[model samples]
Target: MRSSPVSRCRMHCYFETGSPMCGGGTRTVFSKRRAGSGVLSPVREGSTLTHGAQKGSISNYEVYLGALVGTLLGAAPAVLADNPIIQTLYSTDPAPYVWNDTVWLFTGHDEPNSDWFTMKDWRLFSSTDMVNWRDWGKMMSVETFSWASADAWAGQVIERNGKFYYYVPVTRKGSSMGIGVGVSDSITGPYKDAIGAPLVANSAIDPTVWIDDDGQAYLYWGNPNLYYIKLNEDMISYSGGINTVDLSSFQGHFEEAPWLYKRDSTYYLAYAGHCCSEDLRYSTAPGPTGPWTYRGQVMPTQGSSFTNHPGIIDYKDGSYLFYHNGALPGGGGFTRSVAVEKFEYGSDGSIPTMDMTTEGAPQIAPLDPYARVEAETIAFSSGLSTEPSSDGGGIHVTSISNGDYIKVKGVGFGDSGAASVSLRVAAANGGAKVELRLGSRTGAVIASCSVDATGGADVWKTISCPLSGSATGQQDLFFNFVGGGDQNLFKFNWWQFARK
Candidate 1:
């Protein structure tokens, strides 16, 4: 088998909204704060460290020394991320597009606790530093296409003529898998179906789109065989009939997930090669449609998932390869997670073999903490979920419980330091504190602000608290949740720091 056609699976499952598998919960507002207190332990700062009054205090000198000591000891910077980049949900089939200075990652959402590929919608996540990603939530879904019934499998997005177009494979009603195109004015979109019907419908899947310097666009996709169609300037339609790639002329077993990119003058086609367990392989051509010469493996078969997908792009003088793996807790073939690796092509323009890792690509630059940062923007998170805010402000972090934490890696607090921080939060039940910690989750508490009920979980409030210790330079910032009771604590919208 070239690759398992997920749409061909005999079994399928769909969960209703707000189910346990979706991590849904109830919310209620309380006037009184819950009865409980937690010990606030600051990093050792001689005798200056104090813990009480729902706040912790530490010395500025110690913060500086700790940073210096960590640097001297060669401690891995928090900016360096762990793999399976997405922790809040299972995101698969990464399609990375570089627009302006940010990398916009479009992926398909794998439903939780699924026995088979149960995908309904597509998601969008973007990052400036590539370590901390802000979830843009659902960009589009099968619901967007009235004619499509299921299989929001793999898709790719491209920007042309200032408009963003998404190409995805969906199961057509009473028919086989057909490709659909979505278009949006903004990169972050509420995309609409560009064409009411399948752009092309021969049971082909995993659509990857690329445009050449000559203003000609190409859409490539298929399994068991390879095919391409020259897309017109409109993007919603094609210029000619479907064309097939001569698989026999090309080297290697080209399974599926065809990613097309042009490096200088060479056209490269990277795909999932072999079956049962897939590895990444590529072939190079002098032109867009190839007499492709087999280039060896880009990534060997590894990770927990049996199937693999590839998305490659170059951003900010660096080359990155994005792929899917079942590396997260409870992750498997049907519930896959997307991970990225930084790699360099051989001087001859051939790709080098890369490995999937927990410590994913390093932060190209530190994140600016002074700016307003969305709570859903995370490098790593534990015990929390994200959903659309009731205030119509995109997505917010929800389902927060005691000990839940969101880590923002490589946060540059700067030399002047931060004086205080304000958080946009909502709480149904009171008795929760957002602890601002540095370095490690347990490293040191700089500020701990108690959150009170804001009338409803949907009713948001902004609370500001002073920072007791100096938070300067580049550091990994952890928003550690501490509260009493097992019920949901609060919902986090966004946060920003005030300069000292």
Candidate 2:
């Protein structure tokens, strides 16, 4: 007995019998004799033998079983390792912070199809491996602040004494943009207004928070004019009045979006320079607040977005620059998406010019195929969105149309290969097919599973399909969707594979 390819079995068994199994009727026993051996072998008695049969001896039941088994066995996995890490939502003002083993990213949600910066809230996402970002959803919003009337703009979060503090700019009722502080016990927060009033209300914005070596925390933010305040140990209050930074040496246009960080006693102020179409420029200071020396532009004026924001961090021994651009479909200045780049610091602690790219930072490590991966964790996606799942407090891939797909990169299946694939999905309309392809969209289809309606879009049901073929080692995986008409096909929550 030999296992047949999944495609051949699917074509011969499914199309011919209309049943998943060959030789239609329920059977008490099935057997397959080895080719040329002539010895009847019963792998299971009073049970359906769903896999492997002698050539030409495959019954309709066996063919259906073989196809199902192949669908499961050949079920491959995928990963997303491209720029604009979060595909489901448009993110801007990427603020990344390292906590324990994960890089937590906080960003502003750009309203879809907006002509202006009609942002209303902030978003949270995290990733251990840069390739896959876990969407934590809305962490804070304008409604979180009593004094805020509108505009949930660029901000930064820093943990102090187990409490997390977020500094952001929002529109005040009777004034222009003002900075406010939000506090929570955890990094991913349902934070409340730390203070009922604006922290620094002199029309400030784009607050970047950093604590110095001597335990002094500093908040830097402003548009055209840069300002810094020494935050007291309470983190909610400042020791003195806000001090302005002199920008005489910053030669290029100094606009806004200041990212303040220190590396080996060198304090760097990376900001969005120039107006209209801002570029990334930085200056060095001797201390947290300083008479700075300009260090040329870090990134020239480029990318589709007119304005840019910078968020820099060092993770897993690698330096990463997180920024935003109008790169996604229907993206623009008001609908920007966050992106990241890996770079090295000069010996003098200066940042080299970084560029936006579709090929984002390399994966810190290969994805484990045996572990469950969320469907929303995509490298590159088309025609998809995500929402909260009903079964549990988790996210699922949604807004799927025919021909929509997601690509996950560098998925390691190992040498023995996968035995089966299981996907937790739900369909309101049903009749959707998910085709697992390796390497590319038009690549070899390892397995295809038909989705049945699970009553509701959130009603998740696990579907297991047999899989075949050598799905060993590292390879890019693509999940190509197919369904009738233009309606959404199904929602995918998570997927995993069993080892051979």
User: Tens-digit lDDT track for model 1 on 1-500?
Assistant: 11324421111111333321121221100011011211111122122211210111111111232333345446532233356678788789999999989999999988876756789999999998888999999999999999999879899999999899999999899988899999999999979999999999998798888999999999999886789999999999988799998998555478788999999999999998875467789999999998888988888876656568999999998999999876544555666778888888888998998866556788999987789999999988766778988866699998787877888899998999999999999998788999999987777899999999999878989999999888999998989999987547999999999998
Q: State the C-alpha lDDT per candidate.
A: 0.77, 0.74
Clashes of 1: 1
Pairs in steric clash, model 1: 83-358
TM-score of each model, paired residue for residue? 0.85, 0.82
Least well predicted 10-residue stretch by lDDT in candidate 1: 26-35
